[model samples]
Each structure stands twice: as C-alpha cells, then as structure tokens.
Target: MPAEKKAYPLRISPAVLEAMQRWADDDLRSVNAQIEYVLREALRKSGRLKPGQAAPVADDQDDST
Candidate 1:
C-alpha cells in the first residue's frame, strides 16, 4: 500500500517561486514537486538526509518534515 499524503503551506519570495516554476517545467514536474525535489537533493548533499533518514516516499512527499 502507498503512504498517506500530507499538505503544508510554504512561503517564498516571488522571484524564488518563479525560478521554481521554470525549473519544474524544465524537469517535467509540477511546481510543488520541483520544490520538494530540490529541497531533498539539497538536504541529501548536505548530509542532512543520511541513509538512515526516512526516504521520501514519493515525489510529492512533504520534505519539510
């Protein structure tokens, strides 16, 4: 069975939002998905998302958790 989905609000600057939208389109993902992807990658690269850390269950998983 698939995991449950959760929604959370995020606030960002207009410029950042626009950049995310463009990146999402380029990657064939939605704006929300793109943001989560980027954040996950960032965390992983920074060592914050270690192997033991819970993996993102899906593309739309809430990364802020």
Candidate 2:
C-alpha cells in the first residue's frame, strides 16, 4: 500500500516550470512525480529525511536517475 499524499497549491515561474517539465521528461516521470522525486532527493541529501526511512523504490525500475 502507498502512503497518502497531501495536496498543496504551489506557485512557480513559467521558466522554472518549463525547465522542470523538460527534466521530468528526461527522467521518464510525470511533472508532479519528478517534483516529488527531486524534493525527496534534496531532503535526503540534506538529512531532512529520517535515518533508515528512505524514498520508496520502484520495484521494476532502475534508480540510476
């Protein structure tokens, strides 16, 4: 089972959105999913994510991206 997600309205510049969309396409993810992925990575790198609790892995996909 997946954890529930909370929804929030975010405001961003068009250029930033465009760049993120392109990056998301490159990573084979939807824009929203890519945003979550980047955010999770940033959180992990900064030690904001709890120790031993990491982002969920995609069973069939390589996580090289």
Model 2 residue runs over 4 Å out of place are 51-54, 57-65
Q: Write one digit per residue (lDDT tens) for candidate 2, span 1-65.
A: 65556666788899988999899889777667777778888888998997557555442343323
Clashes by residue pair, model 1: none
Give the least accurate 10-residue stretch of model 1, judged by summed lDDT.
56-65
Q: Against the unseen true structure, what C-alpha lDDT does each candidate score?
A: 0.71, 0.71
Query: For residues 1-65, what per-residue lDDT tens digits would candidate 1 score against the true structure?
Result: 55665677888999989988888789877787777678778889999888746555365543432
Q: Which stretches of candidate 1 lie over 4 Å from their true place?
A: 52-65
* Backbone clashes, each candidate: 0, 0
TM-score of each: 0.72, 0.76
lDDT of 2 at 6: 62
